[model samples]
Target: MKYPIMIRVKQKQIAQLVSLGKRLDGRGLNDYRGIQLEVGVVGRAEGSARVRLGKTEVLVGTKIELGEPFPDVPNQGVLTVNAELVPLASPTFEPGPPREDAIELARVVDRGVRESKAIALEELCVEPGKKVFIVFVDVYVLNHDGNLIDASALAALAALLNTKMFNYEVKEGKIEVKPGYKPLSVKNYPIAVTFAQIDDKLVVDPWLEEEQVMDARITITTDKDGKICALQKGGYGYFTTQQVLEAAKIAKEKAEELRKLVVKG
Candidate 1:
């Protein structure tokens, strides 16, 4: 009873504020909240990174293991991404198995990294069809402040950048692990930019409150070449052609700006 009424009141106030090109957090429509990144946090994992986007916090860990390659892509390594939505992150999260939201979150980040070809899979191949190194990317959501897609993607890329490969030698059809390690061969960098449509205006990196009030949302991921590698649309709303194009233009610029933070060059 009162719950529904409170929701409506909040929605109205948020809509009215966005209608005037302002956000509840005092940011412009295109401005994103402050982002903080830390790499090499987990000592045991091959690579690890944590990202703080406003109040949203996400951590990613990368582990490399030896495994057989797929029959079709025998000459390439395999990349698997998994995401966990801890119940403690948000009250809405449950302690059960993986939910649809968690699956979607993992897929979105996976697509951005896969489509961009950021990792050199062929280089990880050991013996063509027989042996290859498998890279596992695990995403851990420490806090749910909205825009999980962008935050996870940022952390994933940062983790990959910090990843290290074990030094080894192929001796008589077997891999002999050495004492040193080399950095993973990372090529392109992909950055995801998310927008939420509220009151006919698009808000960049919408926080939890804006997400609740947004009519529809879209995420555009761009590679280092300023090309869109992946895009995800959510909510029950449509965007005009001009709006899509406008978002693309912004995606390119924002991707570059964000990439600099992860790549450190």
Candidate 2:
């Protein structure tokens, strides 16, 4: 993940600017880059969304299929999340099985959605123990500006919002599809905000240069009620107690702003 000599030089300059409460991109210390979101981008998928944050881009698709419930969770439906770091997105990415970074990205997003109770899985059940819907949320990273975790999480939630469940009928032990669809049952909105630290400066939604120069990064996911649902800290650096608390506050405010974009009619 080492950048060229010139990119590293730029990282130092960016750090210096951040120390002065400025960014190379002219955004405030706590400001996010421009974001654009679109839902229903993939017609074949039950649900899909694409999100762009500055130069980073991601797409998420949700597919619902009828499957047997897990033995331990027989009364509830299933939710699985997978993230792919496409090689075309960055030179650092390789084409193969999921790497450590990709696994971490998927787990963080999954933790946020699962902990927030965003989807009412119980309602997805068609039969108590035998039949239920399996929701597969797949995240594809199109660009690697900096914060893939936030962008992917947002796209996943938005896709879920746009999802339509296939109409189905259950008989003695079989389920049959009908000709209609209904909206997926969504309960809460959970959004993630990421902060990167360099020297003593903290910046929200760091871009590629800032990310490469950062010491550590922390991501806080908050629900609509302003409660922390999940927390993830990456890198070899650590955040102080006060810094973590301050990041939470920043995350809550920014999360509220981002939620509007997802739920927009």
Q: Could you tally the backbone clashes for each prediction?
A: 0, 0
Each prediction's TM-score versus the true structure: 0.97, 0.97
Candidate 1, position 187, lDDT: 90
Tens digits of per-residue lDDT for model 1 on 1-265?
1234566779988899899988889999888899999999999999999999999999999999999999999999999999999998997788989898899899999999999999989999999999999999999999999999999999999999999999999999989999989999889999999999988888899998888778889999999999999999998788998999999999899888898899874
For candidate 2, give the lDDT.
Answer: 0.93
In candidate 1, which residue pairs get closer than 3 Å at backbone N, Cα or C atoms, i.e. clash? none
Across 1-265, the per-residue lDDT of candidate 2 in tens digits comes to 5667888778778888888999998999999999999999999999999999999999999999888999898889999999999999998899999999999999999999999999988988889888889999999999999899999999999999999999888787678889989999899999999999988778999888888888899999999999999999998788999999999999999999999999875
C-alpha root-mean-square deviation, each candidate: 1.8, 1.2
Point out the worst 10-residue segment of candidate 1 by lDDT.
1-10
lDDT of 2 at 116: 99
